[model samples]
Target chain A: MTAVAQPEPARRRTASPLARAWAFVRRNAISVFGVLALVYLLLPIVVVIVFSFNDPAGRYNYTWEGFTTEHWTNPFGPPGLGDAMEASLKVAGLATLAATILGTLAALALVRYHFRGRGATNLLIFIPLAAPEIVLGASLLTLFLNWGVSTGFWTIVIAHIMFCISFVVVTVRARLVGFDRHLEEAAMDLGANEYVTFWKVTLPLIAPGILAGALLAFSLSIDDFVITNFNSGTTVTFPLYVWGSARLGVPPEVNVIGTMIFGVAIAIMLANVLFQWRRTPKGAQ
Target chain B: MTFFHRHRWLTPYVLLAPALAWLVLFFVVPLFWLSITSLQEGTVQVGYTFTWAWENYSNAIREYHTQFFRALLYAGIATVVALLISYPLAYWIAFRGGRWKNVLLLCIIAPFFVTYLIRTLAWQNILSDNGFVLDVLKTIGLVADDGRLLATSTAVVAGITYNFLPFMALPLYVSLEQIDRSLIEAAEDLYASSAKAFLRVTLPLSMPGVIAGTLLTFIPAAGDFINAQLLGTPNQYMIGNVIQSKFLVITDYGQAAALSVLVMAVILVLIAVYTRLLGTERLAG
Candidate 1:
């Protein structure tokens, strides 16, 4: 099928100067642009990392002087950004876990069901996707206040779960659509019940997509600023802390945090790519 | 699968139950309350009560409408910019790049794997007073001796475009990749030039992605507060900032809720029209 589709274009590749130019552009454009775009994306991040060693006064007119770990080692520094960092990690960790579990469950339900109001249910899931973060944060805040719930970790977790579940549902549901039902049927035929069939058969197949979705959720929850800021009360996630610090000009310590997070994300994405490569058929390669 | 077959009516509902319940309780119910609150006029001192005030919407319509349209306008422009930047890159990755495609794709998404706030704030340092870009510009005589790029509306737009470019690119890549190569070859075989072939065949097929990417970028961009707050001054405030202020700082639930509903309704209508035009009967699905 691919042979038939690509034949004439493949043939023309050798003939037309225009085709050769197009091919050359297509071949080199991404690598050229990829490097440029990557630099564009990473330059700011690199500046942050480089300037973290600079003094607080150096923040505005930053320069790479001799290195100092003063900011890093400042346990009792002004504003205690370290405390804010710790608080951010804790909030993000809790939010990640809570969102993952709820989102995964919601994904399972959406995939397995064909019930009434399914259309409405689908719409509801996506509504949050398009929801203004400020509006969501505010609405959640009001709901919490009305219920007398305090603005803290629990509220942040709840809000994160609210927004993050849509991602899991969307991701896992797409995987589920392509997944064959016969595997579960075959498992059932071998005396597995519904729960067993789901646990042993379905879960294994959908686990990757679920993990990917959860990772996306984790990143989103941790990265969230608008919603977290609105509902956080005294709680300060990394983003909120960064926002506050930006007021007095962003602290160099925030750069250290950004660098650490970026490093971890890069490492994980690299692993994901390697894993996907390994998963593809060797014969196909 | 057999159990579902035997109990067909029960299956979908059961699958949909948890998500539906959560959506109704959290999303739909809160929206109902928001709508109700919008129609009422009362400060927190008086406690919110329905005066059936049509004036709040009218007042907001007259006063905040400019900001609302400005936000929409900015988002639209940003979305288009992102699309323009992303489409060629996406096309290169999808059709031209070979085995390096996945690696390049990984790189494109790598930035997003980190927290949004960090990435946005990173730009602060890069575009700050005599920062890297500023230093380069100054060296090139683009800015005066004491000029800065950090707080400008252009920086906000650039920041938004930089961040959302991936969202626009990925969907387009997916749609473009899904398109059969034969159609393009056929267009060429029929005596169409490379450019004409792309215009006739490639563009239409990728429209779905373009629509999805546009909606994805525009919706969030319109509602984004963090960008405006962090990157721009008071004059650059978007409707999302207003919503945040109304709901959080002021506790003006009626106006906040009203604005939320209005934005939500507008987005939904746009999405509906978009899907209809695209002939995607089950858009989210």
Candidate 2:
């Protein structure tokens, strides 16, 4: 607590009024600037949420028409939006599942063992992340085109898992690196085999990281545009649908879905944070 | 040794195999194919062939240098602006948010839950020709009565900065939050002015996050096509837009592949420099 507390008294004894005002501005500048920046960052979100209720007179919901709750009650806006949203969910769900499982396994291997070619494997996992989305998309498209595999829903899922596994591995590896190995050793001493010790102890401890990684994977897959845009031959995910509609003046239903996603994500994250906060005592680690 | 120790040497490899195989098939193989495609002579109708054509690389650069430069310039400026905008916000949350730090961080991230296309589209509406932002600028004499805000470089840059601000903010927050406040206090205690203390201690210590944030912001921002497509005119189109049109519209696979490889190579080189500057362990940690 004293980290910031003890410094307050040092600035109070300034002599002149000008100096005092200067000091005040200096002290408060970062805080004011920060809040304003946050507002700028969130302005679009406020617009999106508020606009969800708009009863636009036209196809596009660009201008604010008088407020109405019509859009929120209608899950599908225009013609194909509901289907697109469903497709997005399906792809994200499958990709997240496959990526999480693969990534968790890889993270376990990386953290728990010293092996030949481990360094190469680490680089391989990292390369997808470091590569730009546009480049990755185009390359993948080229591969698919050359390989005679038509691009669509399955290609989107494959690409999502490809990019997402890196993030999952990175997240889970961080958790694993911080793990208390002694607990596992203690379990072994208590006559538990490796599998029993893992299921009973390690998995439970790292479960939060796994969940976090899965959530991250889902958000990324669902929100993806560039990569999905490339490989989606006639397949329309939510973002792709939005992009296509933007040319024709987007429907208010887009904003409705946007708001719903925002609300759900925030709720899940808050609940997770609360759960973790309750689980850990201060400085227990 | 436990039961698993009977084949301990194989355990890690077995665990890693599935994910590794997935990466190899979807990620590594695609990139290899991209490399081959880059040197091929191609027309989608006629079917492409490997012809050792290197002009695809040179011609893309010569043809689209304007877009390439614009992409670099836009991404570079956006990275700087995002850093400047996010640093104080992140600093405030880290040092002063205290009991509200997690909540503050969540607020910072909340906007991103909205679909990316929607978020960009929201900006498009807000800065529409007759919308709030332009009206304000017009009223304040920042823009002419007939001058438009949308379809300009400023709008494009601002959109990029706003979209990537969270990427910049979160890493900066993590680095700033991890700083030992006692170190800052010690500098103050030694009679160094607050500004001097911050410059010599706080800024340098947070370089890893700053570097990481810049890379995160720049790479994606450079590769971004939606912002320019939605908010700006043909004049504002970036390299990403060009590459997209090449692959999908123009159907110039070889040129697109070469351009993708070039961009990836450039990004890889930048990352190598950054990694060297950060030192490998700092990046790993």
List the candidates' TM-scores in order.
0.89, 0.95
Question: Tens digit of lDDT per residue, candidate 1, span A1-285?
Answer: 243333464456545787778867766866687567667656666666776677655445255566778766752264767677677667667766665666667666676765567677777888888776666776676666555678986677667767777887888778878999989899999999888988899989999888888787877877888888878888776787777776776666666666777788888888887887888766343
True interface contacts reproduced, per candidate: 0.43, 0.77
Which stretches of model 2 miss by more than 4 angstroms?
A6-23, A276-285, B1-4, B277-285
Residue A37 lDDT in candidate 1? 63
Model 1, range B1-285, lDDT digits (tens) per residue? 787768767765665566566666666666666777788878988777778877888887787987798788889889988888788778877875565678888767767755677778767657777467888888899987788788888888888888787888899989998888877777776778777888888888888899889988988888887788878887888888888888878888887778877888788888888779774743443
Local distance difference test scores for all models: 0.75, 0.89
Runs off by more than 4 Å, candidate 1 = A1-10, A13-31, A58-66, A69-83, A146-148, A281-285, B1-12, B138-148, B277-285
Scored by Cα lDDT, where does model 2 land? Answer: 0.89
